[model samples]
Target chain A: MALKLPFLQVDVFTNTPFKGNPVAVINCMNIDESLLSDKQLQAIANWTNLSETTFLFKPTTDGCDYKLRIFTPMCELPFAGHPTIGSCKAFLQFTGQKTAKSLKQECKSGIVNLTISSEGKISFKAPRADIEEIPQDVINEYRKILQIDCVAAPKLLDVGPIWVVYLTSDAESCYNANPDFAQMAIINNKYGHGGIILAGKKPGSSQDYEMRAFVPADGVQEDPVCGSGSIALIRYLQDLHNFTETTEVNITQGGRLTRQGEIFCQIKGNADGAFSYISGGNATIVIEGSINI
Target chain B: MALKLPFLQVDVFTNTPFKGNPVAVINCMNIDESLLSDKQLQAIANWTNLSETTFLFKPTTDGCDYKLRIFTPMCELPFAGHPTIGSCKAFLQFTGQKTAKSLKQECKSGIVNLTISSEGKISFKAPRADIEEIPQDVINEYRKILQIDCVAAPKLLDVGPIWVVYLTSDAESCYNANPDFAQMAIINNKYGHGGIILAGKKPGSSQDYEMRAFVPADGVQEDPVCGSGSIALIRYLQDLHNFTETTEVNITQGGRLTRQGEIFCQIKGNADGAFSYISGGNATIVIEGSINI
Candidate 1:
C-alpha cells in the first residue's frame, strides 16, 4: 500500500505560471515525520528533478506557524530563498490561513520571518551576507571562461549560497555572456562557491538591472530565476556603491531563458549594518496533485 | 483563465516508483490541439524538467489509437523509448482502454507498435539500428576521459538516438566508471552522438549484464535507466556474438545510482537482419494531479 500525500508545484518570483522558478511543496501537516525519512525526501526531490522541493511539517517549536525542510536534487539545504516563498504560498492556500498578516517558519537555520501584503505579496528579510574580494588570477580565468570584460572587480558573497559576483558594463553584456559551464563547475568546486552571478544596470529600462545565475556545480546549468542570487546581488551592489540610505530596485532575470522573472529587492542601512529584503508577488500553483510514496 | 488538464508523473522501466526514469504525461485526448502550440509544449516540458514529457492527443492518422509528442527539457524529440512506454501505460490507465492487447501510437518518427501482456507488461520493438566501429584514436580519448580500459572494441549504434557502446571487463567495472561528463559532452557534441554507454556481463548473477549511460550532451549527467541504450546494447551484443537464433537477456541498470532498474531485452536474427525488443513492467504512477495552464 502507498501513502498518498498532497503536493503542489508553485512558481515563485513571478505570478505567471512557467515564467519563474518552480518548487515542489509537499503538505505533511499531520503526517508522521518518521514515515518520511531523509532518504525518502531526497528521493522525492530527485524524482521531481526541480531546483528545490520542500516538505511542510507541523511546527515543533511554539510561535512558529510551520516547519520547512528544503532539498535540492542532490542534497538537503538548511535554507533556500525561492522554496521559502513558494512553500509559504502553497501552505497558505492549502490551509486557507489568510487572516494572518505574517508567519514564522522554523527550519535548520532557525526561525525566518515572512510578511504578507493585502494583495498577497510575500517578503522575507534576507540573512546578512559576508563579502570578500576575488583574486586577480581567478578573475582572469573567469573572464576567459565567460568571455566578458568586467566593469568592476568581482567579489564573492556568501548569503547561504555563495555567489561569485561579476559586474559588466551594460545589460547587453550580461545577456551576451556565454560561460563554459564545465569550467565554471570546476572553479566553483575548487573554491567552494555555489555559482556565478552576472549583472548590469539598465538606466532607462523599467527594471533597474538585469541578472543571470549559473550554478553548474549544483547541477543547474542556469537558474531560471534565483532568490538567494538576488539577495547576494543586493549585498554586492550596496558594497560597490556605498549606499547610506534605504534603497529599492526592480531586477529583471530569466529573460534570456524566455522567462520574465521580476524581483523586488530592498536594502536598509542602519547603525548596526545593512539588511536586505526580497519581495515578490504571490506564487501561482501550476500543478496540484498528490504523490504516493 | 487557466485551463486545467490532467497530468501524471510515471516511473518507467520498473514496477516500483522512484527507482526508474520518470516521464511527465499530459492527457490531452479531448482538448483542442490548437490550444497547445509547439511553444506551449516546449514550455511545459521545460517546466516539468524531466528527461521527457509526452502529450497525448487524438490520432491524426488513421488506424492509430493516439498521437504522441515527446519533448525533453531542451527540445522536442522525434521518438524516444521510455516516453513511448510510459505514455502508452498512462493513456491506457487514463482512458481505461485495457481490453486491447496491442496499440499503435503515431509519432513524428512514424507509427510505433506496443504490445501489452496479460500481466500488464509493455513491450515495443526497437528501431533498426545502424552500427559502425569507433576509430581507435577517439576510443583512446574516451579511455582517457573515462579512466577505464575497454575489454572489447566499442561500436556506435544508431537506434533512433545514437549510443557509443563500450564493453568493459566486468560488472564491477561498469559500476565503478567515473567519466568526465563535461569532457564527454564536448566529445559527443563533436561526434554527433547521443551519449556513452558502459556495459559488462555478469555470468552468474540473476541479471546477465549491468549497464550505465552518461548523456551530458543531453543535459543529463547519468540517465538512471535508459531504454534506447538498452536496445543499442542488445544490438551490439548480437553483432559481437554472431547470434544466429533468438536471444534474450535480463539487464540490471541504475544500481550505481541506488536505483534498481530491471530491463528485459530480446534480439531475433533472420536472413534480413536482427531486430531488438525492449520490455519492462507496468509503469507506476507516482504523482497524479491536474495542471493549470
Candidate 2:
C-alpha cells in the first residue's frame, strides 16, 4: 500500500508565479501515526530538486501553531527564511486558515513569529545576526576573485546561515560583476561560510539596492533570490549606515537571471537595540498535488 | 482564470522510487489552444529545478504517437535519454495506454522509437556516435585534474550530447575518483562538450562496470545516473573490445551518492555495423498533480 501525502510547490518572495525562489512544501500534519524519517525527508527534497523543501507537522510545543522542518537538496537546515514564509503560506492555504493574522512556527532553530499583513504579505523578525569584520588580506583576495570595486569594507554576518557580504560601488556593478565560483567555493569552505552576497545601491530605481548571491558551496552557483541573504544585507546596512530609526528598504534581486524578486525589509531601533525584519508578498502555489510513498 | 495542467514527477533508470534520476513530465496534450510558448516551458523547467523536464503534446507529424520537448533547468535539449524513457512512461500512465508495446515520439531531434518489453522495461536504440581520440597533452591535463590512472586512451563520443569518456583501472577508482569540477568545466566549455564520464570495470560484481558523470558545464556537479553517458560507455567498449556479437552489459551508477541506478546496455552487430541500445526498468511516478498557470 502507498501512503499519499499532500504537496505544494510555492514561489516565495514574490506574489507573481515563477518570479521568485520556489520551495516544496509537504503537509505531514494529517499523518498521525507514521512520521517520515530524516532520510525520507532528505530523499524527497532531493527528488524535488528545489533549493529548499519543508515539511509541516502539528506543533509539539505549546503556543506554536505548527512545526516545520527545512531541507535543501543536499542537507537539512535549522531554519531558512524563504522556506519559512513559503511554508506558512502553504499551511494557511492547505488548512484554510485565512482569518489568522499571526502565527508561531516551531523548528530546530526555535520559535519564529510571523505576521500576516492586510495585503496578505508575510513578515518574520530576523534572528539577531553576529557580525565579524573580514580581514584585509581576505578582502583583497575576494576583490580579486570577484573583480569588483568595493565601496565599503566587507563583513561576515551570521543570522543562522553565514554570509560573506560586499558593498559594491553601484547597481550596474552588481549586475555586471561575475566572480569565479570555484575560487569562491574554496574560500567559503575555508572560512566555513554559507554563501557570498554582493549588493550595490540603486538610488534612482524603485528598489533601494540590487543584490546577487552565490553559494557554490551549497551547489548553487547563483541563487535566483535569497531571503536570508537579504536579511544579512539589512544587518550590514544597520551596522554601517547607523539605522537608528525605523526604516523600510526595498531590494531587487535575480535581475541578471531574468527574475524579478522583490524583498521588503524593515529595521527597528528600540531600547533593546536594532532589529531587522524580512518581509515578502504572498506566495503563489504553482503546483498543488500529492506524493505517494 | 487559471489554466490547470497535469504534471507528473517520474524517477527514471530504476524501478524503485527515489533511486534514480527524476524528470518532471507535463502533459499538454489536452490543451487544444493557446499553446505554451518556449519561454513558459523554460520557466516551468527552471521552476522544477530537475535535471530535465519534459512536455508531452499531440503528435505534430505522421506516424508519431506523441511529441515531446525536453528542457533542463537552464536550456532545452534536442534529445535526452532519461527524459525520453521517463516521459514515455508518464504519457502511457496518463492516457491509460496499457496495451501498447511500442511507440514513436517526435521531437526536435526527429523521431525516436521506444519498445516495451514483456516485463515493462523500456528500451531505445541509441543514435550512432561519432568518436574522436583525445590529444595526449589534453589527456595528461585531464589525468592531473581527475587524479586517476586511465587504463585506456580517452575519447570524445558524440551521440547527440558529447561526452568526454575515460576507462579507469577499476570500479573502486571510479567510486573514489574526484575531479576539480571547475577545471573540468573550463575544459568542457573550451571543447564544446556536454559532460565527462568515468567508468571502471567491476568484473566480479553484479554489474559489469561502475560509472560516474560530472557535468559542471550544465551546472550539475555530479549527475546521479546518466543514460546518455551509459550509451557512450557502451560505444567506447565496442570501439575498444571489438564486440562483434550481441552482448549485454550491466552498469551501476550513483553508488557514491547512495543511489542505486542500474543501466542495461545491448550491443548488436549486423550488416549495418554495430549499434547500441539503452534500456531501463519501469519508471516510478513519485508525484502526480496539477499546475496552474
List model 2 lDDT by residue over B51-95, tens digit each: 999999999899998999999878999888889999999999899
Pairs with steric clashes in candidate 2: none
Tens digits of per-residue lDDT for model 1 on A41-150? 99889878998999999999999999999999888998888899999999998898877789998988888888888988887777557899999998998898888999
The 10 consecutive residues of candidate 2 chain B with the worst lDDT sum are B274-283
lDDT per residue as tens, model 2, A1-293: 45788989999888777888899998989885246778888987887789999999989999999999999878999988889999999999899988889999999989998989888888887755678999999899889989988999999999889998899988889989989988899888988988889999996763388899999888888998888888888888888888668878788888777678888887777678746556555578888998877
Shift of residue B10 alpha carbon in model 1, Å: 0.4
What would the TM-score be for candidate 2 when compared with the true structure?
Answer: 0.95
What are the per-model numbers of colliding residue pairs? 0, 0
- Report the TM-score of chain B alone for all candidates: 0.95, 0.95
Question: Deviation in angstroms for B103 in model 2?
Answer: 0.6
- The lDDT for every candidate, in the order shown, is 0.86, 0.85
Q: B262, model 2: CA deviation in Å? A: 1.1
